[model samples]
Structure formats: C-alpha cells, structure tokens
Target: MSIKITGTGSYIPNVITKNADFHQHEFYNIDGSTFPGDNESTIQKFKAITGIKERRYLDDNLNTSEMAIIAAQKAIEASGIDPETLDYIIVAHNYGDVKFNCHQSDTVPSMATRVKHHLRIKNPSCVGYDVLFGCPGWIEGLIQAQAFIRAGMAKKCLVIGAEALSRVVDKHDRDSMIFSDGAGAAVLESSEEKGGILAHESATYAYNEANYIYFGKSNNAEAPQDLRYIKMNGRKIYEFALVNVPKAMKSCLEKSGKSIKDLKKIFIHQANEKMDDAIIKRFYNLHGLDVPEYVTPMTIQELGNSSVATVPTLLDLVINGEIENQELKDGDVMIFASVGAGMNINAVVYQY
Candidate 1:
C-alpha cells in the first residue's frame, strides 16, 4: 500500500510580532550582558540576515496541543476523513504543551494524546504519540505514517507538528527573534496508488552539541534560573545545515529513483533565507544544474521559524494556491527537507 497525503492544514496564531517592534524592548547577549546595538539598526541587520520581517505567536491561553488540534481539524475537514476513523495521530513538537494554562510546560500525556482528546476521536485504538526530532520531527512523523500504512497496521494517520516557541524562547536572547508559534498537519491515507512518500533519508551528528538547544540560565545570569529557554550557537547550526541538508536531499532523491529534473517544488525548512538558498543551490550543483528560482518556495520572510511546522504550512499554502504561481498537479514530484537542533536532518520525496 502507498501512503498519500489527502489533505493539509495549518494554524498560525493571529498575533503578529514584527521585527521592527523588537527595538522597543531590551535584549541581552548570550552572557546576559546588556546588548549595545541600536534597536533600529539591529532590526535592519536581522532583516538582511534572516529575511524575516515578522512572525506569529499563540495567544496567552493557547498551547501546543491546542494549536495542533486546530490544524488537525482543518486537515480532517479537508481530507473529508472522519476523526473517529483515524488510525493514528502523530504529533511532532520540540516543546510539548508548552505554556499550559499560561504558566507551565509538560509532556506526560503527549501532544498527540491531548489533540486526540480535543478532537474527540472516540476510537480507543487510534494510537496517539509525539515524536521529538528537532525541526525534522514532522517529516519524521510522515515517515512513520508511511511505514504503518505499508505494514498494514494502519489505513490512515494524522501527522502534526505544533510549537509554542513564543512561550519557550527567552525574551532577552537573540534566538527569540527567529522562533515563532504555529502548527501544521496532514492527513495521510493508505492507497493503492504508488506515489505519496516515495523515499526519505535522515541523519544525526551527535557530536555537534554546541548547536543543540538546552534548558538553562544564561552563562552570566546571577539570579535564580527561571524557565529554560531555547538557546543555540548559530554558527555551528549554519555550518551543519550548509553541509548536510543537501547531502540528505540528494540521497533521498537517489533512493526514490528520481532525478532533479523530475521534481516540482522543494518545500525546505523555513529556518533562514540565505541558508535555504545555499542548500538548494548546492543540491542542484550535485546534479550539475543551476538552481531554479521557483523550485524552492519560501515563507520564512513572514513566518520566521516555527521549527517543524515550517514545511507543512508552506506545503498547505502552495497546495491551496496561497503562494503565487505555485500549485501541484496530479503526479507531480516534490521534495521536503529540514535540519535543526538534534543536529538532526531529514529529507522526503512525495508525489502529488
């Protein structure tokens, strides 16, 4: 059996955080020292570097699971699939149920479990769980869904990636500018049709610990540590993605027996505009072809980085004609790639 994504959905909170607004608030260096740059120039520099003009954040009352439910509802509605009939719900999130009740974070019941409850999915056998694979979590969830369908263990699965990064990111840290909140979901159904998830590849560079996220106080903090916020060494992550993501995409393409010439669009992780351009350019070079302008569609300029939600949300936008001059026809081949905090990376090929 082949696994096909019958529907796609995404939910971004209504609150817009513009880069220009950051200067109104004070920021701190990683060492907790006062940042010295002028806010206006800093915002301009950030725009030039990341191409992010703004991003959305969940409301105070919302949490990761709730966002996942909203996105899942849309996906089920689009797929015309009854929630009662879903065989599984796989939620991919870096921080599970962050900002629960506007005060705390917890993962005991799993984001998928909470989403299942919210959707009122009555089937006791509709397995629900969460996957933690950094930014590639959603794509990894898709891989698992494909496996279940191929193994005849499940006929349909809802794959969701939701994050409330706004709640977890330290307001004082520079990393806060790039993180956002949102969720994206897809309904994958078993089909006799041959092309859905064609082939995929993933890897982890465990030694690249400096690029990973951790929960702790700043290096220079003297006060009692509060919540552990998202932290990272930007240079390491840039170097890692520049080298590995293209390799993973190329391997996935080779595994799927498809060539660069056969692809339609490449939905890459909305991490950074320049990094994405470089990665795609390198991938094309591997095939001895120039990178096509339209081959990789992007939303990072407006969405920032919501980790795993980036790719699926972009996919939904393209599928529904939300992106200009981008639409998928039946039998079109597409590629998805992401790299992040696990020092983890993944790539998947799909046919629409």
Candidate 2:
C-alpha cells in the first residue's frame, strides 16, 4: 500500500498588492532607524533579489480558517471523497487567524477544528488538529498523514496550510513586502498504487538558529510597547537555508532509492527567488549534476511568500495546468522541500 495525494487545492486571494503600493510608505530598519535611500530603489533591489512583483492579501472579511475551508472543499471535490469518511484533518499554520487590524491570534478551537466545522463533517472519529512547523508546515502535514496511514491509524486525511500573513506584518519593516496571504490543501489516502510517497526528511536546528524568525516589536519603535509583529533576520535565514536545505533534500531522495536524474520537478517553498535558486543549484551539485532548465516551477514571482501555503499552492497550480510550461504527469518523480521558522527544514521524495 502507498499513501498518495489523491487531490489538491488552493485559495489564491483576489486582492493584488503590487510592489509600487509601498512606494509612499515609511520604511525603517530593525533598530528603528530611518531606512536609507528612497522607496523606489528599495523596491527595485527587493525585486532583483526576490523576484516578487505582486502578492495576494486576504480580503478584510475572511480569516485564515475560512480560507482553509475553501481549499479543503476544493480538495474534497477534486478527490470525489465523502467528507464524513475522512479520518483526520490537519491544518498547518504559524499565526492562527488574525483579523484585519487585530493583533491577537485566534486558535482556541484550533484551525483544524475550524476547518472540520466549516466543512460540516459530522463524524466524531474524524480527529482534527493543527501543526505549527512554520513554512514547511503543509509538507510536514503530508508527512504526518503518510505516517498515520502506514501505521493503520487512518485511511484518508485532509492536510491544509493556510495563513493571513498580511495581518501579521509590520508595515514599517521592509520584509513585510515579502509576505502575502493564501491557503493550500490536499487529500491523502491509502491506495494500491505502485508509486506515492517514497521517503521524507525533517530537522529543526534550534540550538543556535532558534531566533532567525520571530515575533518582535515593530520597526517603528514608538508604535506600541506591548504589540509585536512577524520579523526575521533575512541574511541569517538565507545563509542558513543555503547551508542546510540542499543536504536535507539529498538525504530524502537517497532514502527513496532514487537518483538525482530521476527528479522531474522540485516544489520548494516560495520564500525568495534567489535563495531558492541557490538551494536548487547546490542540491544538484551534491549529485555532481547541473541544474536542469525549468526543473523548478515558481509562483513566488507573483504570489510572494505565504509561508506554509507556498509548496502546496505551487503543487496545486502545476497539477491543474494553471502554470504555463509546468505539468505533472503520472510516473513522475518529484521533490517537495521547505525551510522556515523553528529554523526548520523538510523534504519529501514523492512519485506522481
């Protein structure tokens, strides 16, 4: 038996925020000092490094759980599965649901419970829970689902990654422009298929990197003493990812009994274009191979970094033929990888 991703779905918000939108906003350094140079030059440098021209933000009326519900519905529909038959519902996220202009994160009932409730699944045995593993959360959710199936604890599961990052960002911080809001989901089930998830690798380097990404007071020091927003040490994260992520991916692929040449595509977290490009190059170098053209499909150029939502969202788009020149075919070998807060990193070697 194999655990296969039977269906995939994603919710890309309708609100398009262009880079030019920040041109008039005040930018500040992490130490609350005035940002050097003007907004145009700042944005240009940002674009050159990250390749993000625009991003999507959740509408004011919707929250992260609501977006999860939508993506879950689509996945359920695509899978043609009865909602009541699901054995587990896993929602991955960082900040629960932060209402527009609200600083508090609502996770009392848990995002998974909220999704199951909104999906209207009445089965009491369909356990619902949340996983807080940072941007790799969704991929981690998939790994968990596979474990449950392999252990005979579940037959079918729904895994979702959703976030309203726009609501958690500090406008005064330039990194705020790198964040957006979205959700993605997939249905996993045990099947007699020959190829599915072959292997996975996960790690947390919190000893010295625990604070690479964290919540801190806004760049505007005088804004509030008690309130905090999502923040990160960009240079630290980039350096850390380059050193560690490729090794994890290589380990996973090796465990799958597959060679580097077998990989058809790589679905990596949409954090930064340059960072991802560097990771992929290093990944191939480990195998003494050159990076293949179009081996990686990216949505980051338009969708920005939506944390947990990036990998699954990219998979959903490619599988549905929404991304030009990128397609997933049966019998294709692929790698899914991500790195984020918790100083965490994970990779899954899957056969489509």
Winner by TM-score = 2
Predicted structure 1: lDDT: 0.87
TM-score of each: 0.96, 0.99
Model 1 clashing residue pairs (backbone): none
lDDT digits (tens) for residues 264-338 of candidate 2: 999999999999999999999998999998899999999999999999899999999999999988999999999
Each model's C-alpha lDDT?
Answer: 0.87, 0.96
Q: What does candidate 1 score on TM?
A: 0.96
Candidate 2 runs further than 4 Å off: none
Q: Where's the lowest-lDDT run of ten residues in candidate 1?
A: 218-227
Per-candidate RMSD, Å: 1.6, 0.6
